[model samples]
Every structure is written in structure tokens, then in C-alpha cells.
Target: MDSQRRQLHLFFLPYLAQGHMIPAIDMAKLFASKGLKISIVTTPLHASLLSKTIEKGKTLGFKLDVLIIEFPCVQVGLPNGFESYHMATSPDLRQKFLKATTILEHPLGELLQEHRPDCLVASVMFPWATVVARKFGIPRLIFHATSFFSICTSECLRLYEPHKNISSDSEPFIIPNFPNEIKLTRKQLPELFTQKVNDAGLMELYKQVIEAELTSYGAIFNSFYELEPAYADYYKRVLGRKAWHIGPVSLCNKENEDKARRGKEASIHGHECLKWLNSKEPNSVVYVCFGSMANFNDSQLMEIAMGLEASQQQFIWVVKREKNGGGKEEWLPEGFEKRVEGNGLIIRGWAPQVLILDHEAVGGFVTHCGWNSTLEGVAAGVPMVTWPVSAEQFYNEKLVTQVLRIGVGVGAQQWVRFLGDSIRREAIEKGLLRIMVGEEAEEMRSRARELGKMGNRAIEEGGSSYSDLNALIDNLRSHSFAVEE
Candidate 1:
């Protein structure tokens, strides 16, 4: 905690998903450590998902309070009840969700009026939350749930029409006027902004995003300075917003203080996943998991299984039975599981991803290129074998490969919107072999370690991210409605 900074009464509202909610919860804990009271506004379901963690967090004086919000999936047949992510694919759902939540605005305003917290923090994807903040004159700090690269891509698209048709395989093309590592073929942009997505609800949602981008006074990013200094500097120098990169939100949790930062080779439990890594050789085992939302097609799943076995390396893979509403299972290439079962541990549904990444046995991450996964891997100093699924993952993949040299993307071309065209099985095997077991793999692993150490250093006393967060809170205090404007 920075003593010179004034304490805040913070209200955080995530975009209503596991990935979004987890980080918001972590930030609440961090604010508590600074002796601030935090009110987290989310739906009943989301609150239930985090109940156990909140129970454990009480030791630090953090409070997790739930607020009711409408979920359309319960009324309509959209997947998982969250409208924002699924909105790109469903305009009817988006409009329906917007209407439902619009009814929530006044009740929310009344809640805030009653509580009168000093500041409001929201995920950038949801602008309705921002409206509530504006109504109350509360300072709004939008935390992007993605890399600087994705935000840059969105901003560029909002300005220039020429960079609108680029593809993933196309050569480097500049993002109009921006002086960051932002380049894209129209295809390399998120599928939402692609010309291919014109028929979907993406165009409408993109408009909402542009509006939010123009409005926020402050921003929070989940990256360390060493990982993206140029972009961080660009935001500070050019964007003129109060930006804070205080993250790897996992570190703010009580896990590190439990005296059980898992060492190598313990009987693996949820809390002990990293402990098993302690027993493995350096750069040996591969960590295989996607962000909670990013999973593969049935055919792609088979290819990955073959690839993992063919790499001939140890692996810990999280295999969820179904993804979204894509229910049921894909039959494995017969007997492959039996062959590698002794050398692997397959966790289904959910795994303690951050805890596993912090382990010694984990040498490399096979990620779907979600911004959270990408940043978490970076914070852990784990080099990646990039295989993006969708949303801003393509942007994240570009950041991992081009901006940071610690990872390799397997596909010759990415940013695809179709299902039938997936990467080949042999290609998956070869990519893993190169990134996990070969000499180049060892080199990448060392780079990842160096990067991870730098990220950790940035959060210690007097670290860049630490100082920046303190500054952000100070600015939040100054802008409080209870004080002045």
C-alpha cells in the first residue's frame, strides 16, 4: 500500500464471466490489502461461483457482496446467460439483453446512491456499467480484459477504413496513425471486426466499444511493464489517460501467503498442481489448457490429442467434456489415452490455471491466445505455443509472436472464422516438439523464465506496476464525486 495515496471506496463490476469475475475478485483483494473497502457488483450465479474464494479472503478484511443482475440465458436460449461475449453472434440476444439490463440501470443507480462508493471500475466490454458511473459522477476506470494489441486494433479500426480488409497471412500493414506494434490484415483483427462478421451482431457491439473507448478517464491493464513497455509508454505519452498495469491478478490472492507454494512432486490436488511440477526436469512437461471459454472443435480436439502424444513429452491437459452448448464428446484416436495415461494427468471442467502455471514442472503453455491466458503465461515467464480460438485471441497471438519473441504460432495463417479448416495433426505434433522438447524449445523456456522474473519484480515494493496502481488510486480519490467533480 502507498501511504501517500488516499484510501478509496471502490466498486468493481466485471462483465459476468468466470475469467472476468476472477480478476475482478483479485483486484478487490488487492484493494483490501491497501485498506480500502470494495463492493463487487455481479449476478447471483457469479457470486456463487466465487463464494468459496470469498470465504477464504475474509482473513484479509476483504468483503464480497453480490448484487442482482438479469441474465438473458435464463429467460432466452443464449448460452451461459452472459450476453456480452455471445452478443457478437446474436443481435436479437444483444438487443434483448440490453433491454433487460436497461431496466437495471435505475435500480443500480439507486443502489449506488444509497452506498455512494468513491469510484467504479468496470470491464471495458460492458458500457452499461459506465452509464451508471456517469449518472453518479463517479470516476470510471475501464480495465481492458485483453492485451494492448487488441485495444490498439479496435481503436485503429474505429479510425481507418483502409486497414479494414487485411488477413492473418498477409504481410505487415500499419494501423493508421498509431505508433505501437499494432499491425493487421483485415483478417488478423478480431473476427468481430472482420468484414466476415458484418452480418452478425458484431458491428453493433463494436459501435458500443468505440463509445466506451472515447469516454473513460482512467484504465487498468493486466500486464507488467517489461512485457509491453512500448505500448505502456505510448498510452502514457500519447493517449494521456491514467493507465495502471498492476496485475497478474493471481498474485494478489492468498495462495502465495499460504506457505504451500507447491513444490515439485507432491500428490497432485487442486492446490498442489504446481507441487507436481517441482519433481519434473526443466523444460520437460507441457501445460495444456485454454482460457475458461476457449475450447476446440471435435476434429481439432482429436488432432491435439495426437499431437500431445506424438510430442513424446509429459503433459497435464485440462479436457472439459463440453464447451459452451457444444455438448457431448469426441472419441479419441483409439487407445491413445491408454498409451500416455501414465505420463499425463487429464483434468476436466476446471483446473487451478494460475497455480499450475506457477509450478516447476510446467515448461510451456499451449494456449488459445485469450488475453488473460497470454498475460498470465507472460507473468509466469512461460513461453507459449500459440493456437488461438476466437474473439481477440488472434490479436493476442500476434502480440505473443511479433511483439514478444517468447512464443511461436503453429499455423501458417490464422484469424479464421470457419470450422472445417483446422490445423493438421502432424503439424500440432511438430509444433509442440519444436516448442517443448528441441533445443529451440529450451531457449524459449529460458526466455520465458527471464520474462516471468521481470513481471514478478514489477509488483514488489517500489516496482513500476505497484507505483502506477498507487498513482491510479490517488487520481481516483481526487476525482471522487464526494470530493469535487
Candidate 2:
């Protein structure tokens, strides 16, 4: 198949989180830009979101063709049709996801036979994807929703044996080959690691990476060379196949925006936030957001509020309003909200984060360092003030602060979680001050800018990331009837 005449099809299954959804959407748009046929598969709930987003895609050169599947989350004790970001309900999310996977094979098989897509790309979290692809004799690829570090840790754990000496709360032994030398606790890894999976009954999910690893044709990670070349190299060398890094997928947002200035499904609430951002000073505002999945307890929330108050910096904070999650002003020092009224924006619930980061007013981002937020921050050319909330975010912090020198994390020691411990007002204030004006801080800002440029260039018409993507397609077709355009 030649470039223009080539008709390529891809099946995308994300873990149903904001970080995963955004990148998948972006990839869809990128393929559209190249004049390829697009079909994105998802649960009915995500299908609604995608259907709405496809209207935005028309403005770019793409239109999303969705294959909606019934979600079996009800069987897993989860309510049906829950939104992508299920915060308070996340504990049951993995199980629901696992249940949903069992439903994928039959429905997905029918869709594939009818549509005949060129390939299937499933989220790393969705273990069943690779299996069905193998049984159907289709080329399969795993999309690394987290990072190379997450994959490394997971792979190493699969290689290790469970000693069976620990109780429910006892932490598993840390695996080797994790770079940057940080410690992980049972609390930090996914809940699956702690639980005894029920393979016979509950959701027959593939909890083992080894199982999916053997089933996949390749894996696609949404990262670039500059950010994680070392780990990327190790992943490819270890996995022994092409692990492609084609990213800054968020940049495709520009390609998807409408002339009316409406972003793809930009909510009335999120647009209002964007309007506020437009009113701020160039490179003077601090954009704060924790991707949809993370939620903070009240004490931690209060400490963070006080720190922002003490920093006396212009900032924004995104939080979910759980019935008990502290109030915006309640956490701050008395009258602090009144004092910083003009300088700060405390946006609870969802916001147009991509729009905010891309704004001229955003100079720095205070984040949980989720992969989506991290890549968006770097792609926007903004430096970071990392306060990692959970999971692989601690390792991501190391990439920013230690390896790449583009961000500063709060804790000096890699205390992944310090729930009983707190970073008070003075420490938060000092950290903010140093991030903005300190010489070493300035150096970080410079690196962030460079990384931002590289990120854009990589996805551009003739860039390294673009070439890598083409190469992957080329290789995948080497044995087949040529790759799709």
C-alpha cells in the first residue's frame, strides 16, 4: 500500500481516565491529518464523549467513527455509564474495567470482522485486548497509558515471585531495574498488586503483564526521546520489539479546535476557566491541576492551601468536591481568599487544562505529575512544581527534577507519600519562591522551554517522532500487504 491510497484502521481501548482519553483522541486526530480512515472503539459512556468530540474533530482534518460497546461494570458492582473520571468510585474501577474486558472479545470480534481494521491497539491496563487480537490473528499493540517507568516496574514485578509471607497490608518487595533510585510502598502501586485476583469468577482480567506481553505485536508509549530516552532504550532492549514513542499528543488539540473557539467538548464550566486565563498576564500565572483520577484528603488539602497562601504566588488549584473534601476558602488561612482574590483561581471540578497550559499567562504548573499533565506541561513550554499524589507519579517527578532538570518536586527525599507528615505554609511558600526566581530554578525553566520546543518538533511534519511512527507502520506491514497510509 502506498501513502495516499493506504486505508489504515486502529482499535483504541483506554483505561477510561482523562489522561488516557485525551491522548487516544489526539492520536485519532493525527491519523486523520494524514488522510487515514479512523475508527475508535470504546464503552458506550466513552462513546458519548467521543461522539461529542468528533464534532470538534471536523474542524481539524478528522472525524471519529465510534464503535460503542456495552459496559459490564454493573456486574462488578459499579453503576453503568459512569463518566471517564470516576474518583470516589475508583476502588471498584479496576474490577469494572476487568468485567468490561470480558465483554470486549465477542463485541470487538464482531466489529473487527465487519470493519476489518488494520490493527488493534489496547491500553496497557486492558489485559484482554492483546489476547483477542492474538486469537483473531490481528496485529496488536499496547498503549502505555502511564510511562516507561510504570512498564519497567510492572515487568520486573511479573518476573518476581510472590513470597506469600505478607498480610493484606504488608507491602510487596520492590522490584529491581527501576531507575532514579526511589522507594515504592504498597500504597503507591496499583491496588491490584495488593489483592488476590479472582480469575474464576469476578472479572477474568489479565492481571499479569507477562500474559499481555506475549500477546501484543508491539507497544505504543506517548512520550518522546528527550524526556525518557534511557528508559525507552531499556524498554525496547528488554521487550525485544519496537516500542514506539510518538507523543505530545495534546498538541493535536490545536488541530481539533473550531473556528468558533470551541475546544472539542469544552464544557461551559471549562470555557469559563479559559476565559479567566485569557485575562491573566503573560507567563505570570501558575496553572494548577491534578488530573481527574487523584483526590486529596482534607488535611493534605488544607496544608496545600496554606502553602499557596504563604507563597504569595499567582496560582490555580483543581480539586473534586467530595461531600467531605474541604471547602475552597475553608482550607485557606482566614481571609486568605479575600487577600488573593485577584491573584489566584481555585477551580474545583473540571477545567479546560490543555487550554490553560497553552495560554500565554501560564508560566508554571503545579501538578501531581500524571503522565497526561506532565506531557502537556512540557509541551506547553511551562516549568513545573511537582507534588506527586500517587502511583508512578513519584518516578515521573524524578524524571522532571533529577534526570531532565525541568521541574522541582516538593519533598527533598522521595517520600512518595507523607500523609501523616505535612508540607506547611513556609515550606510551600519557599519552594514556590525558589521555583520562580532562584538561579537553579531559572535553569529548570530554560530546560522546560527547550523540551517544549523539542516536543512540538517531534510531532511536526518532518520530526523524529513522526519518523518513528512511520517506521513502526512500515515495519508492521513488512510481512503483510503493506502498511496503511
Candidate 3:
């Protein structure tokens, strides 16, 4: 017991985005609960965003600290509050945000040298953390907030370059060295791999991230073995590193019966949404949300709204208004709100997704297929209607619809900031119906429920993830002792 409290300390450097930061906070809380001292390093604003989670950790009797380093917003010529990736309004600004992360190297190095935590667990964004950790002889663990399948697929894409010989961006190509015959078009690949961007700095940062993963002591995945056992095994064989699968970390946020009894649902949106879900029958409502960063043009929003109306399923849709405010007044068709009032609820901004997904009424999800949203939906046992909008989301959609067999696709083949004729109301309605009420819906729902059960069991005592967490703790403890000696 005394040795369990070896005073081992771990510093976490998560990307300053809601999806990345939340999972990092949960991982920290998980470690702290097991007697390790944890500090999450972030900027002042990012720290504030996580204040509630940090406070909750304290309340639960854990030592979880938020160490704030100055963000180089002004130096980087970024607009005020545009410190993180998701805050960027344009692709140029997004590149600037990536550059700003590198500015933390000096301060982070100083902090690491001064505090000298046993290990530094950093998300792939701040690859420089690996250099700083090495300088201080700290074991660096890269936190990939993605699945083993994604990691493996991305790595294979890098090594094989199968897309290079394809005739066009839309041409289908199979990813080599993967556990399965996973095929993707060049358009579905991450932007970094597809072509050179205007921002040299961002491109260089991507290279650095890959290099950091190669050089780090090991990588930690926000996933569990059962979730992707083949990929988990394949990743180790290919990467030749000690990667640990100790997650579904978001499951740490699960509200117990006691909390539910006390009316504590993890509703970040209006309680009215959950209340609306409660009034509906079990496995009836189709919830639609395309993450924080996806911005749909007026045409796209109208098409979606019309599609939902056509589906005739009970629905809850969270709409993110366009950044330039171009489409707010004109986005939805006239009287569309009034028409679907009884069967649908449309939230304008952030919705408490976890709470909604875990609700009985939420039978189907129309998602952008971001990794965070995918994992959350999987954990909640909700099948998805994949409508990938941008970033690595298209690949994530493939993972869900094709690989996992737990989602149906809306056939959104490419990322778009504006609506094109590529996706219409009819196609959107077809996908929604397929996931919500079609022949495959029940089978998909069963697969999702099975995976959800496995995810829950993975985090339980004597489970694979539980053992991995303990193993990580013990490994860090031994490292701390050896360094002291």
C-alpha cells in the first residue's frame, strides 16, 4: 500500500480542443484515482474549460492539477480566443493555431525541467513535448485520441502510399498491411497525406507528430482491446512499441444510479432536450449532431431539415450556426420549425451529447463521425448514420459503416464547407430511414449494444483495460524509483 503511493507524478499535454481535452481530463482523473499525482498542462483559457472536471476530481479525492502556460496568441497574430484548433474560423487560421502550439516548447521545457514529472503524456499536437521529456529523462507517452484502427490505417497509408498511383482523388484504393481489406479513396485521406497545404508550418508539424510517435517510449490509446483487438495487436507488431489500451476513458463520466436518482444527468445542453427524450418511446428518436467544428451552409442545413421531416422519425438535431452568420436567418426552410415541432427538437448550439446518447429514446445518431463522437456513441450503444463533414471524419465514417458494421452512411464522400448537389435531401432521408427504421437498424443496434457492453466491462475490475491501467501505474512507479536510485 505504501509503495502504491510512490509519489509518482505524471504531466499531461492535451490538444486544446473540447474532444481532446475532455478525454485527457478523464484519463488524468482515472490515474489520480489510483494514487498518482497528475497535472494537466494547458493555456489559461483551456484550463478554465476543464475547471469543472478538475474540481470534480478534487471532490472525488484525487490530486489533479491544471498547470497553465501562456498561449502565444498575440505572437502568432491569431485573433483573440483563437488559441485552439476548433476556434479557428478559416483554414489559414487553423494553420496558425497549429503553429501556436509549437510556441509552448520553451515554457513547457522549463516547467518539465523544474517539476520533472515521472512521465509526460502528451497528445500528438505538441510533438515538441517528446524532445523536452527526453531532455529531462522523462518517459514520454504519446496520447493518441484515436482508435488503434485509425493509427494502424494512417501508418499503413504513410508507409504504402497506395493512393499515389490512383487515377483521381475519388478512385478507390485499398490500404496495405491492414488487418482487413479496408479501402479508401484519396479524398477520404487526411488533408496532410493527400496534398501539400498552404501552411508549411502545419505540414512540418504533422511530420513532427509522426516522428514523435516513433521516438516516444510508447503510445497510449483512448480505446480498449476488445473494441479493436486485431488492430491493437497489429499496431504493436508494426509500430514495435509498448502501446497500452486503457480506455473508453469517457466511461469515467458515467453517472451511477445514485447520481441519476439525485437527478444528475451529464446534460451540457438544456435539460429540456433530455426531458423531450423522456416523453418519447424507447429506441425511437434519431439524434443529429455534426460535432463542434462542422459548419454546414444554408443549403446543406435546409436539405438536412427537409430530410429529417421526410424520415418522420422522432428527432433531436443540434445545429451550429455558420461562423460568418450568413445562414442563421435563412438556413432552415420557412415554417420548418413549426412543421416538425411535435416530433423534432432543433438545438442551435452545443448539446449535451453524452446525456442524449445514453438516453433510451436516442435509437439512432446522425454523426460527423469524429473520433470522440464515435467513441461516445459506441459507449452509449447508439447506432450511427454517418455524415462525415471534414478532417479525418470520412475515414471514421468508413470505420463505423464498413468495418464495424454498426452504422449506415449518408454517402458524404467528401468534406464541404458549402452544400453541393453531391448530397441531396433524398439521399439524406434514405440514410436516416436506413439507420432509424430499416431492416438493418435492429442488427446495427444489436452490434452497437454488444460493443457498448464490452466497453463497459473493459473498464470494470479484473477487466483488460483495468489491468492495463494498473500495469501503467506500476511501470511508472518503478521508473520513478529507479530514477531516484
Local distance difference test values of all predictions, in order: 0.68, 0.68, 0.81
lDDT of 2 by residue, 295-379 (tens): 6667677777888877777887766652335554454456766788878887666667777787788888888888888888989
Q: Once superposed on the true structure, which residue ranges of model 1 sit more than 4 Å away at CA? A: 1-7, 70-103, 165-172, 176-183, 198-201, 254-268, 271-279, 322-329, 412-421, 481-485
TM-scores, all candidates, are 0.86, 0.84, 0.93
In candidate 1, residue 232 scores what lDDT? 73
Better of 2 and 3 by lDDT: 3
Candidate 1 residue-wise lDDT, 284-385, digit = tens: 778888766554677877888888888788988876553335433563667666798657767665666777777766778888887777877887778898
- Summarize candidate 3's per-residue lDDT along 50-149 as a digit string, tens digits: 6666677788888899898998988888867775677776777776787788888899998997888999999987899889899999899999888888
Query: Lowest lDDT 10-mer window, candidate 2?
Result: 255-264
Once model 2 is optimally superposed onto the true structure by TM-score, how far is the C-alpha of residue 468 displaced, in angstroms?
1.3
TM-score of candidate 3 versus the correct structure, residues matched by position:
0.93
Best by TM-score: 3
